[model samples]
Target: MLDALAARAAGPGRITVFEPSPHLWRGRPYGPDLESVLVNAPPAIMSIRHGDLGHYAAWLGGRAAEHLDPLLGEPLVPRALYGEYLEHTAETALAALREAGWEVRVVRSRVTGATGAGTRMVLGTEDGQRHEADHVVLCVGGGTPPDLYGLDGAPGFAGDPYPLRRTLDRIPSGSDVGVIGSGLTAVDVVVSLAARGHTGRISLLSRSGMLPHVWQRPVERQPRFVTTDRVAALHRERGTVALDDLVGLLRDEIDSAGEDFAAFTAELLAAETDDPVRRLRAQLDAVDDHRIGRRFLQLTAHTVGPYAWRLLPAADRARLRRRLRTATGVASPMVPVNASILMRLFDSGQLDAVAGVRAIEAVNGRFHISGDQGRRTTAVLVNAVNPAPQSIPRGAAQLVDALAADGTAALHPDGGLASTDPRLHVIGDLAAGGSFITSSIPAVAFQSARAAAAVTAASDSGRALSG
Candidate 1:
């Protein structure tokens, strides 16, 4: 967002950012962490600058080789390394803004309340300071992972597994560790533990023991049938795009590339019921898949996903929600390096994942887990289940509530905040009425561009009226 504003704003204006964290540009996910924790997406899709496919890669010029993952055929850098990119990008943006006659200030405080003050908005911070702004954009990021088992203060329980450097050392090297989700965060915990030379047995407990699919070597193919323009055209013609309409577009995309749609859909469905080890093995073997279905879906997810989501009828949305687990697994695959680590652990009988987790209890200084696979105990338990999309962070909850209570903003029926005032905007994952998978960097960049344009246009309008 700062990048967008720097490039487009016709400003000799002031911009103040209230950030309480010492790691300014590097949020929780990209903060200092074990080298094993990697940026999940490819460089092409991870750019902070909107519409610039090679932005991140251009910055990684000479050091790309050091972070390259051979299996995925991409430089999956450490989270800390990526944080450096963010910091550099932010500094560059700030420099550009200063050159453009804009004064930018960063405040080390958290916002606690927001209320409308005549034509402006007044923001109150935790440190008992209030600042007024003509426009406000909430970039609070996502919420912390919830503790599902009521083990917040348990001796051996880790409520959040982030910055694993802080949590991993406390656990005995040979003690059993249990992770509570089968998503990317869980993958991080497992891979980081192995990287630290921890020989403990590890188990991933979930309602559906479905791990993310393995990412294939990316191909240089753009979608012809599944583009955003085509989706908009469909909505114009039919008023709404149904689930079957999307499937038809996908089929056309795959068939045009000379792949069998039936075979592809069947394989995707089979993955949900297939054994986790065998499924992962199959995915690993097929990393060089010649089929275009997966690639098409990956490209369409962020590019066309938001538009299609808005046009989808309630029934179609509900149907997609029913299969969200499978859809998310396919859309957000893990990089091959982590998949290989998991494979090695599975081969050594030191790691396993089980579904239908019924209950978890803290007992006798250990964690006991009961599920479909029956009872098991572990020396340490880590919560890896991410919060739902657009969940308000605990720190920002009071501010969001205040805005809603006073009608400055309204809570979306779906998640996130909806602005009632033109001066206020929402971006990133907190923007309401976005796709379920709207938290990606590409999506955030898209939203940032829109918000920046809106803010600048409004500023220009105000100036012209005064003149």
Candidate 2:
């Protein structure tokens, strides 16, 4: 996102980034991290430009040639390596802009609040400093994890789950650790802990108790069904796809699989009678190509997830949420290596699963977690649930909250905020009416480019009108 913004805002007025880190391009995902931390996808699909899918590959070839031996193939490189790529990308863009005579400053401070309006906007920082700008883009990345069980600031609870390498260190070695969710973040926590040689009982607790599915090596194939044009057609015809139509489209796709649609979907949604850990482990061992089915369904969702979300009536959205919300946790499966480590831990009796963890109460420097099935107490409890986009303020940046409070920004009916003040634009997960899969590097790049173009056009128009 910073790369896109820097390119657009170059050759003119100052473009000041309010990030405390000089290497703002790295963001949080690509920040300095252990080599054990690998990217979910390969180098091919990671470039900022859609045409240059191999840009990152080329970068790797020069900087870290060993990691790029397979050249055109997909290899999950280290996360920090990606960080270095981003820093290099940003530096190159900055140098070009400087040569073209534009001032750029990567300010090192937290933006406390954004006040005022329109072209007169003032972004206040923690040190009682303010920076004025004509347009503010709210690409502040992911929000804090929602306090699912109100465990914020508790002794044995961790609300913010990033830098798992450090946060997991607080847990005493050999102490039982209860992880609250079983999504990607939870998998990372478990994997990081095991890598650190923390020999302790790790309990993965959740309502469904389902971990992410294993990822397979990519096969070159375009989306067969659920094309974007189909979604556009629906919008063209009725302007909105009701909950029933959405379900019917999925059912149609399932029918195309040559199986009993009803039975197939039922089996898909049915709970595993066997232990989930054992099931995932067996999957890892057998390594079937069954991910094709999941990939199709996922691609279908991505095609319509964002637009369909906005078109739904408020009541329908709530119904859809109630039915499909929990399914999201297991939607995007984890990378294979991480899944393997988790399976190994579970097999070794060091890791466990607890179902229906509804609440956590801290006591005696420990956490007592209770749920529908049963209860358990653990020495340390880590909240592994990923941040929810719907929950505003709880996980949102303070600037977003402040703007929201004063109605400078308005929450989109779909999810994120829209600001009438200063034409504040929100994108990525923070943008309500966008795909839930924006966490992907490609998705972020695409959206960032679009946002930068929009910002440039808006700035140009403002200048023209003023002149």
Candidate 3:
């Protein structure tokens, strides 16, 4: 979106981006030294620009082709290299903005709040400086997670297990590491430890004991019976569809697929494959023709998720929250290589998946966990959970909280912060509930274009009025 902002703002006032880190545009996911961590999506699907799905690949082809790894005939590049790619893209955008005589400034302080009326906005910084801008874009992805389990400040309790390559290093060699969560973040933690040749038993603790499904590069699919257009039509006819209605629709689609859908789901959840990664990839290959159909349905869900989510009665939304892990497990699967690394660890008796994580307590100079399998002691407890939709506070940051406090910012009933004043635009993960999937690169790019267009139009209108 920053890229789009840079490209579209031709009649601009100064463009200032507040990034407290040296890693501009790269953000948290693409931070430095995370070379071993693999991206969940293939290079084919990860482009910061719309209609140019191969943008990242093309960039890599020119500079870092060697970083590409061929798995299942798709390129899975290192996360750090992707970070470098983003930095380069940002540099290009900045250069273009400068060439067009627009001042582009990167603020190196933490932005806490943005408050003002109409076009005049005051952005508050942590250092007591109130920087002003004509427009403010809240690209604050995910705010830092509070210690959900009250394990903060405890010995060997590592909060924010990000830049995993570095954080996991603090664990002693051969120490047992208990990671709370089964998503990509947890996978990265285990993969990072394994890649660093750390000899330790890594336990993945989750509610369902279900790992993210292994991903295959999607084949072209057509939505035969289930399409977004149809879902939108249903929404029009009913004015709103309940959660049960949507589920029934999905069940019908799966039923229409007959044996193929049944087999795929069966294989996906079955414990038959000791090597879960290989089994999943093989299952996907077996259903190659039908794989895209499932993907198309998933895409439809992404399209309908926001509407369905918002239309859902409060009770149904609660149900959705309860089933979120299952929804996430199927909807956002991991790439094969990361799963393969996990499978290898599992096979080596170095990793185990534990269920029923009921509690965590500091005990005897170590961390003790009581869960589905009873109690276990570990030398390190790492929180690898990603911040979910409900995690963002009204005042997630100082600026956001202040906006909420003064009634300048309104919380979207679904998710995200909206400024009562038009100049403030919030997007990304923070804009959850506004869209079903805002975390992916493609989703972010799509959103960035829309937001950029609106901001640019406003800038042009301002210029015209002044002229």
Model 1 steric clash pairs: none
User: What TM value does model 2 have?
Assistant: 0.85
**lDDT, candidate 3, at 277:** 47
User: On residues 315-365, what C-alpha lDDT tens digit does candidate 3 reach at each position?
Assistant: 787776665665676667776677767777877888888877888889888
Which regions of candidate 2 deviate over 4 angstroms?
6-10, 21-23, 50-52, 62-73, 116-119, 150-156, 243-264, 271-274, 285-291, 324-326, 390-397, 413-415, 435-439, 459-467
Q: State which candidate has the highest lDDT.
A: 1
In Å, residue 187's CA in model 3 sits off its true spot by 0.7
Quote each prediction's TM-score: 0.97, 0.85, 0.87
Which is superior by TM-score, 2 or 3?
3
Candidates sorted by TM-score, descending order? 1, 3, 2
Kindly provide the TM-score of model 1 when superposed on the true structure, using C-alpha atoms: 0.97
RMSD after Cα superposition, model 3? 3.9
**Model 3 global lDDT (CA atoms, 0 to 1):** 0.69
Q: After TM-score superposition, what is the CA distance of residue 257 in candidate 2 from its true location, in Å?
A: 6.7
* Candidate 2: clashing pairs of residues: 20-108, 416-432
